[model samples]
Target: MSSYAAVLRTPHACRAFAVGLLGRLSYGVVPLALVLAVKEGSGSYAVAGSVMALFGVSGVLLSPVRAGLVDRYGPRRALVPMAGGYAALLVVIAGVCLRGGASGVELCVLAGAAGTCTPPLGPTMRALWSELLPDRRMLETAYSLDGVCEELLFVGGPLLVGALVQYAHPATAIALGAALVLAGTVGMTGSPAVRGMGGGEQAERDGARGAWGAPWRPALVAAGVGVGLGGVDLLVIAFADGQGRPSVVPWLLAALSVGSTVGGLVNGAVRWGGSARGRLAPLAAGLAGALALAGFVPDPYLMAVALALAGLFVAPALTTAYLYADELATPGTRTRAGAWVNTAVNAGSSGSSAAVGLVLGQLPLALCFVLAGVPALGSALAVRASRGARAGVPRPESVTRVDPREPRSTAGR
Candidate 1:
C-alpha cells in the first residue's frame, strides 16, 4: 500500500516531472515553427510541408547515434552538450529565416541541422522514468502520465504557435520555444535523478559497445504505429487543404491529440490484469479501422470525429510497445532501449511524412488517410505474430535494475 504521492516526493520523481514538461514543450513548438518558417521563407505550402517533413527526418537519422552516445556516456554527459547544441541550432535557424533571402535548399539544410541536433528529450525523459520508478504499476502509471503530457503538447503547442505566427510573428514563437528548451533541459540535467544515472564504470564500458539487449520485434512493431500516426497527421493537414479549410487543420489534428490524452489518462487510472500483448491486438485493430474510416468520411466534422476515435488507441499501443521494449532491454542500457523506441517512432513518422506528402500531391486526401492506416494494420499483424511466437513470456517491470555495487535504498531492495 505505498502511496503514489510519497513516490512523487522523491528527487527522481521530481526530475521526471520537470524533464517531461520540458520535453513536451520543446516538441510542441516543432510543427508550428516548421509551418511558419516555410510559409515565411519559401512562400509555398508544398515547401513548408517538406520542411516540416525534414524535422522528422533529422530526428530519425540522428536518434540512434545519440542513443548510442547516451548508452556510452550516460544521460547527463550526453544531454548537457546536446541541449546546448540544440539551442544554438535553433538560433541559427531563426537567424537564417530572419535574413529573408535564404534559398529553399539552404533552409532545408538548416532544418535538417535543427532536426539532427534536436535534443533527445523523449528518450532522456523515459530513461529518467525507468530509473525513478522501480515498481511495475508505478512505472506504467508514469508512462501513462507522460503520454497525457504528450497529448497536451500536441493540443496546445500548435495552436499557440499558430496564433503567434498568424498574429505576432513566427520569430517570436520560435524564440520563446528556444528559450523554454534551454531552461528546461538545463534544469532537468541538474536534478539528482539524471545525475545519479550510469555510475558503474564496468557497465558503462560494456554499454559503450551497444551491449544493451533489446527486443527488435516489438520495437519494429511500434515503429509502424509511429509511421501510421505520423501519416495521419499529414493526411489531416492535406484533407483540410483539399477542402479549402486549411485554418481547421490544427483543430483537426488537435482532435486526435485530445483523444490520445484522454486515452492515456484512462489507462493510467485503470488497472488491467493481463498481458501487454493481450491488449495489443485489439487496440491496433481498433486504431487501423478508425484510421481507415477517417479516409472515407466526406464531411470534415465526421473526419475529425473519426480521427478522435482513431487516436483512442494511440497511447495504449505505444505504452504496450514500451512495455515490450522493457521486457527485452538489458541492464545499463535501458535508456538506449527507450531511445530506440523513440527513434523508431520518429523514423517511422519521418519516412511516412515524406512518402505521404508525395501521395497527397497525387491522390485524394481520403485515399491518403486510407494509405496511412496501412502501417497501423501492419503493426497489428506484427504484434499478433510475435504474441503467437513468444507465447507466455514474462514481461519485465521496467528497463533499469539496481547495481549490487552501488548503495541500494531499502525501498529499491
Candidate 2:
C-alpha cells in the first residue's frame, strides 16, 4: 500500500511541475514567435511591435471573461478547450504568415484572437496548488516555486526560439511551441488532481449573480505599480535600441527577473507575523527606492543594477495584491479576482508601451526612465493612503484550505 501510494504521489508532482514549465514556456515563446513572424513576413519592427501591443490588448479584454469561465466551470474544463483553441489559432497564424503573407492589420487581428484564446493558466494553476496543498506554508512555497519556474521560462524560451530560427526553420519553432501548449494543456486537464476536483458550481452561480462592487483600492494601487514597471521596461528597450545594442534589452529584463525570483524565494522561506496590512508600507517604500534608483542611474550596467533592486519589491507587491484579492473576492469569484489583477497589469503595460513608442524617437531615453518611475511613486502613495484608511478595520484571517471537490462553506462572513 505504501509503495502504491508513493508511485501515485510521484506522478502527480511530476505532472504539476510539467504543467508549470509548459505554462511559462508558452507565454514566453508567443512574443518571440510573433516577433519572428512579423520580421519575416512584413519586415517592419514597428508593425511587429504593434502586433505585440494588440496581443496585450486582447489579453486585457479577455482575461476577466476567461476568469469567469474558470469560475463557472472548473479550471480543467476551461483550460483544455481554450488551450486547444489557442494551438489551432497559432498554427493558422503561422501558416498565413509563412505562405500567404499576413498584412499588418491581419496579423493584429490574428494575434488578438490568439491572445483571447489563451487560458487563465496562472490563476488556475494557483487554484490547483491551493486545492492540493491546503496549508498556507505549502501554498507560499508553491507560489515561490512558480516564480522560479517563470524565470526559467523567460531564460530558456527565447534561447530556444532564437536557436530554432537561426539553425532550424522558424516554422519549426512555431510548430514546437504549439505542440508544447497542446501537450501541456492535455496533460493538465487529464490529471486526476485537477479534473477530479472543482469548486462547487452553485457557489459560483451565486457569486456571479451578485452586484459587481466598486474596484478595490489596493488593487488599483497595484495596477498603478504595474503601469510604472511597464513604462520602465519600454524605456529600457528604447534605450537599448537607440544605443544600437538591442540584444542587451533581454539581459536588463533578466536582471529584474533574477532579483524578483530571489525575493520570492526569500519571502517564502521566512515567516512574517504582521497583518497583511502591515507589510504594505515596506513594500511601497522598497518600490519607491528602486524606482528612484532606476530613474537616477546613468550607465547601462548601473541602470540594470537599479532595475534589479526595484524588482525585489515587484514579486512581493504582486503576492500582496493576490492576497488582497483573495480577501476582497466573493466566495466563488477568486479566479476572476486574480484575473482582474492580471488584466490590470497587462492593460497598464499595453497603454505605457503605446505611449512610449510615439515619443521614444523625440525624447531622451533617460527622461523616459525618470517619467516611468513617477507612476511607481504614485502607486506607493496610493497604497499608503489606503492602508491608513483601513488601519482600524479588522481583516479576516487568511484561508488557504481549498477542497475544490467539496462544496464551499457559507459560514464565513
**Which one is best on TM-score?**
2
lDDT of each: 0.70, 0.67
Per-residue accuracy of model 1 over 301-396 as CA lDDT, tens digit each: 998899889878889778777766654555466666777777777778768877987877798766777777777788777767763343322434
The TM-score values for the models, in the order shown, are 0.82, 0.83
Error of 2 at 87 (Å): 0.7
**Candidate 2: residue 277 lDDT (0-100):** 45
Candidate 2 ranges with C-alpha deviation above 4 Å: 1-14, 43-47, 103-105, 196-199, 209-215, 237-250, 357-367, 387-413
Put down candidate 2 lDDT per residue, 251-357, tens digits, no spaces.
89888887887776676666566654456556756776677667666667987898788888877766666655654555456577667777776676667666777
Q: Tell me the deviation in Å of residue 3 in model 1.
A: 8.3
Clashes by residue pair, model 2: 198-404
The segments of candidate 1 whose C-alpha lies over 4 angstroms from its true place after superposition are 1-7, 38-54, 103-106, 166-168, 202-214, 234-251, 295-302, 357-371, 387-413
Which run of 10 residues does model 1 get worst, by summed lDDT? 404-413
In candidate 2, clashing pairs total 1
